[model samples]
Target: MTSAASKTFVRRLGVLLGAAGLAAPLTVAMGATAQAATSACTAGTGPYQAKAERFLGRTVDGKQSAADCRAIRDFQLDHGISPAIGYAGPVTWAVMDLVSQQRAAGDNPNAAGRCPVNKGRIACVDLTRQLTWIQDGKRLKSGPVPIRSGRDGYETRTGLKKIYWRSIDHWSTLYEVRMPYSQFFDGGQAFHSIDGSVWSAPGSHGCVNMRRADARSYWSLLKNGDDVYVYGRKPGT
Candidate 1:
């Protein structure tokens, strides 16, 4: 991006959200009820849950509707935070600002005991944490972003691989789904953007799903032959 564009992007990101709720990018099922929403937002305080709910345009009772959780995932994706698996994790919690939490507490620059991959400018995918980030050595370049990988039977592959190809606008032949900003590393699995609703559940056939914004950022930072280290085990793996 040009300097002017970068500045414009930052400025856009800096824009504070108004009192109005965030528009749902994808359609949310009307299945969410007050009780169900309340239970979903049970991760924390009423105020915080309310924040997430209101942000998602759900009931202000701090209930987490299916749509609310999915909307949070969308927010995470847009901000480049990862395991786009929808849950109010540290990053999400902090972003919601409903509670007082340390944002830097769990950051594993070294990736610690998980699948620690020390490579120059690598995209580290921690399936265990459901997070992905780009790093140059120990320096984080892009994110420790949340991501959603393949589900139980269709778990994402672990170990080292290299980016072999990239498609800015690609379509999955088998699944016939739109995979925007795809960066293929493993055979069929790549880092790509998925629909907002996809993050509400443990899903994906066998790929890492990022937010379209994050995928675009990854496209800008990564290239063919770039080291792609996917490690740790997906939940329940």
Candidate 2:
């Protein structure tokens, strides 16, 4: 399979989890409570047993609701951490610690260079820890920012692509673009921050979501005719 296709499969199979409270991106369905709604933030867990049972394609009963599962996922995503599918692993814990440090720092050190491609610069989305910047010939730091991505079918398109144009302080995204520029692909997709809720649940209509602070930063730093790249979850559980 192609690398992108492979990555998608891996992400699906892996069943990566997020923190228990902070939301990022990723639709979650536990036992019965499946619905999409933004609400007050607090903190929490999904039914591990239910998740495992579902993995086997078997039905199971539980106290965990779809909201619970989504909340947990959102927590992880917003925090730049990943959850363990079955048992807690070292990597999961490490990601938690790293995410905590990053959140505390409140600055994206990764943005200190050029964009991954030779054309533009790089920026880090503090919310999801996903990087987006201009990629022309190399990577550079456009600015420090925050972002969230897809929960399901409309997962953010990653890898190398050129920025079609720019939209400063846009209503949807701080910056917008047309990527891949391939056949039958809609070029209106954009990269910006979230304006509604902080929960990282699966949301957005095919755009890369970010925090307003980060989005504004990107708006002020990046120029038109740059490149952008984003990296996120992959398949294989």
- Which candidate has the highest TM-score of all? 1
TM-score each candidate: 0.57, 0.42
Q: Please identify model 2 stretches exceeding 4 Å from their true place.
A: 1-98, 101-128, 131-144, 169-186, 234-237
In Å, residue 140's CA in model 1 sits off its true spot by 0.9
Q: Write the per-residue lDDT of candidate 2 for residues 1-237, one digit (tens) a residue.
A: 666875576467435534343233343342222234223222223335354334333345533445444444454454444431222233333344334444553333444442243433533232244333322244334433334455467665655554566655344233353222111112655666565532334445556665666566656655555445555452210
Q: How well is each residue in 144-228 modelled by candidate 1, as lDDT tens digits?
A: 6667789889999988899999999999889888999999999999999986643345567789998778888999999999998
How many steric overlaps does candidate 1 have? 12
**Number of the predicted model whose lDDT against the real structure is largest:** 1
Local distance difference test scores for all models: 0.67, 0.43
RMSD each, Å? 14.2, 14.8
